[model samples]
Target: MDKDKSIDHQLRATWQAVAKMYNEQAANYGSTMAMAFVLLTIDKENGTPSTALGPLMGMEPTSLSRILKSMEDKGAISREKNPEDGRSVIIKLTAYGLEMRKFSKSHVYQFNNVVREYVTEKELDSFFKVTSTINKLIADKEIYNAISQDK
Candidate 1:
């Protein structure tokens, strides 16, 4: 099948383009798209658990750790012992981090607004449904299982 007609290829290509756009915006603030993502994922009023951050963002532990370390060094976030779980820590955003979160949120809203302008509501709804179905298929292991069963 042609790559242009492949669903996964289209998704991957669109995501890469979106990532590049976000990274360019983040660069002005001395940040990366990943860092902005982490900033947005963190809880504002209550801190998020360090252990939960990785799974929440679909990120690996090592990568999350490095980002957290950098955020700490930059005074964007601070780590404190989790009272509920001594073995884990809670990641809290500082004033600078809060400010950055706002910036990140604005960019996200702007992206959505721009897309909404071009895409109709029905089209956007269909897009969401399709993506959700794709996620559900993968999550259920239906794709691979069906392939294996066919053999």
Candidate 2:
């Protein structure tokens, strides 16, 4: 058994590599990977609730705020008060934003296709299983609470 190889370490390394790859590709369009992600997340038609965007993207409100502001300034997105709920806001994508979203979606699909070409069906299934297990464990607070209890 190789104790040096940890699941978290592997996940971190894989994510770092993926992020770098995305950033490199996004640079050609004069945008960061993060911006492309937000573009892709927003609703192209009906628009999305502003309060829900952060949780949907698994991002901190402060971080999301900066991205939202940048997107608004670029005229890629617009914000308006939600008619149903005046206290809340809605995020709508502009025509330019729709174009950018399509571009971002294409890159994401290309990446998945490339990965699928290399990874087998069985391996991919197992990878999803592992990830789902990890998510469940975190949601249940099994790992953290267990260790804290030991100490």
Q: Pick the candidate with the highest lDDT.
A: 1
TM-score for each candidate, following the candidate numbering:
0.98, 0.93
Q: Return the TM-score for candidate 2, rounded to 2 decimals.
A: 0.93
lDDT of 1: 0.96
lDDT of 1 by residue, 1-151 (tens): 9999999999999999999999999999999999999999999989899989999999999999999999899899999999998999999999999999999999999999999999999999999999999999999999999999999
Lowest-sum lDDT 10-residue window in model 1: 67-76
- Clash pairs, candidate 1, are none
What are the per-model C-alpha RMSD values against the true structure? 0.7, 1.7
Candidate 2 lDDT score relative to the true structure = 0.91
Off by over 4 Å in 2: 1-4, 149-151
What tens digits encode model 2's per-residue C-alpha lDDT throughout 36-87?
9899888788899999999999999999999899889888899999999999
Where does candidate 2 clash, by residue pair? none
Judge candidate 2 at residue 142 and give its lDDT: 96
